[model samples]
Target: MNKKSCLNCGHTISDEFCPHCGQKSDTARITVHSLIKNDILGSIWHVEAKFLHTLKNIVFRPGKTGMDYIAGKRIRYNNFISLLLVLFGFNVLSYHYYEKFAPAQPLTDDVIYVKDFFSKYSKIILFVIIPMLAINAYSLFRRIKLNIAEHFIIGTVSLLGILILFLLSDIVSLIGLWKPVEKIFNIIDKIIFGLSILFPAITYWTAFKNSYSKPGLLWRVSVLYVLMGIETLIITAVLYEIF
Candidate 1:
């Protein structure tokens, strides 16, 4: 085989990849086959691997995952912002379909308007809300000494977990069994809502405990829950006023 120059940096190379710039040496002419196989399919698989790895860590070891990512061990996980965007897409799609296909309940104009507004602006709302939560977290846990950006990363992971629960709740609500038994459906809805809130609290507590080596686990967890509640209330009030 002839030694070829690196297309990226013009360095001479004999191996399959450029040592200087790390670009693949086999940069052949582009074709439809190569585009589909290497670019589209390969990228999908790579993203899927990173996403699932990050999700597993977020689900089982959220604090350690957040700490690792903040500490610069990020090759194994998807970026926090990327994950948040994916979650937002999933949330919007799931809720939109749920509202469209599920049996309609008679809602007042104000209630319908609020729901529509939230559905349209959920991502914008989250963009604002997550930073506020991050600020509260940083303030409450200043003893740990992490900066606001690190806290924001932690907040994003916590929100990702909540988004998963929210998707699950939407799935459960779409089940056909709910139509016949109004009482049962309402009860299940309340339960799912409660679990959505509780799971995120647990997620945040675990992540905080792992990320920060603080002494007061119980106290920290309690205070964190309080902060979350306050944040939720404030967000709800703001949304209500806006819509």
Candidate 2:
């Protein structure tokens, strides 16, 4: 059989990975190990190695990720929407399994779930349009020439930041510090709120850095970041709690 050519580049290699483009090589072999390694595990992840790598770095280095993304280092990271879908899907599956094993006590209070749902979901539904619109408005306000799509992309990246933190917060919860875990999450929630505002604000700054003359905008930027972040968190919590 003729060897498969690199989809990324014209180079060819005989293994499962391309030496030149680093793209995974697809073959006709059908083995159980290959199926597990390639189909189940690699399908979601290996499809975008660079993206996973970038995601790792971004998770560790909070503000710097967006900066790097906007600075044209995107090849190393999954596209904003793609990454969100993957991470969000992982969260959903995780919570589902967790709930399956350790179900939330049936709500004794009739208003509890409802109130929590609204408290979280309402903002998400409202902000479904706000972040994008806000970005467009801010872009126009600053006279920076970009598209609404850019706003969407920036909004997505900002949202991912929140998800990463939330996931980290979840990991922290398993350390057997339930009370402290709750407090830490509360604090992180506030911090995330701050960061959300900071997110778009920085995204704006980065997007419009060429035109904006402000030198030290981090403080004001942080305010917006936090507020918007809270909104994002509300939405995330709603979705998570529901499913």
Candidate 3:
């Protein structure tokens, strides 16, 4: 029955929260006690829970999650960059362990080379790979009616799913440090690596299977592979020139 402006967005409020921005209607001045109780205790838990929820959604149902985000169900989810940063941190830690605890027999030179290359250029490679794959998917899947930006989200989510599979494979490979388990882990690693290779195509097919007739979908996926190959070549050439 009383009118007040929301401190966050300066929107007029009549109830407990400002509907415009969802900030609490009764804004209070920051104090040490409030900071500890409300922000440190409350906000941290809220943020942590939200991040886990978002990660679960992204990992379990990337396509549906992407669609829901674009459709405005965004309050509970972190954006692509936030989750990517978390993944990047995970990669950094994994690489550190892989280096500090070197495998007993040492990996092949090709594997070492691949690891070094990605370690040095992962940030740059990520910027290129995610967007390029997104563009390719957007181009082929335009029938879904998502704008380029929306498709960008879908593309990145799909790629993020692929990244998770590879990261798990790499983590699994780490167990190979134990010689007795090394051979078995290596076999498991190869299987996971094989799955990672096909994950993108398989995920795309599954997402679009009902969106288009089988032949139509297959043709689009085929072109997507060609475009992805060309994109990879272009990125490699550019990165080679630079570093």
**What's the residue-level lDDT of 60 in candidate 3?**
70
Which of 1 and 2 is the better model by TM-score?
A: 1
lDDT, candidate 1, residue 73? 95
**Whole-structure CA lDDT of model 2:** 0.59
Ten-residue region with minimum lDDT total, candidate 3: 198-207
lDDT for each candidate structure: 0.77, 0.59, 0.77
What's the C-alpha lDDT at position 174 in model 3? Answer: 77
What lDDT tens digits, residue by residue, belong to model 3 across residues 1-243?
A: 989888889888999989998888767998999899888999998999988887777667766777788899898887776787787777678767876787456689988876677678877876676677678888788888777788677767766666676677768767887788999998998887787676667767766677999999889888987897888888877776676
lDDT of 1: 0.77
| TM-score: model 3 vs. ground truth | 0.79
Best candidate per lDDT, number?
Answer: 3
lDDT of 2 by residue, 133-154 (tens): 4564454544544456545555
Error of 1 at 51 (Å): 2.4
For model 2, the stretches where C-alpha displacement exceeds 4 angstroms are 1-48, 60-73, 97-111, 115-143, 177-243
Clashes of 1: 1
Where does candidate 3 stray beyond 4 Å? 1-11, 26-37, 104-115, 179-184
Clash pairs detected, candidate 2: 51-78, 193-226, 194-226, 196-225, 197-224, 197-225, 197-226, 198-225
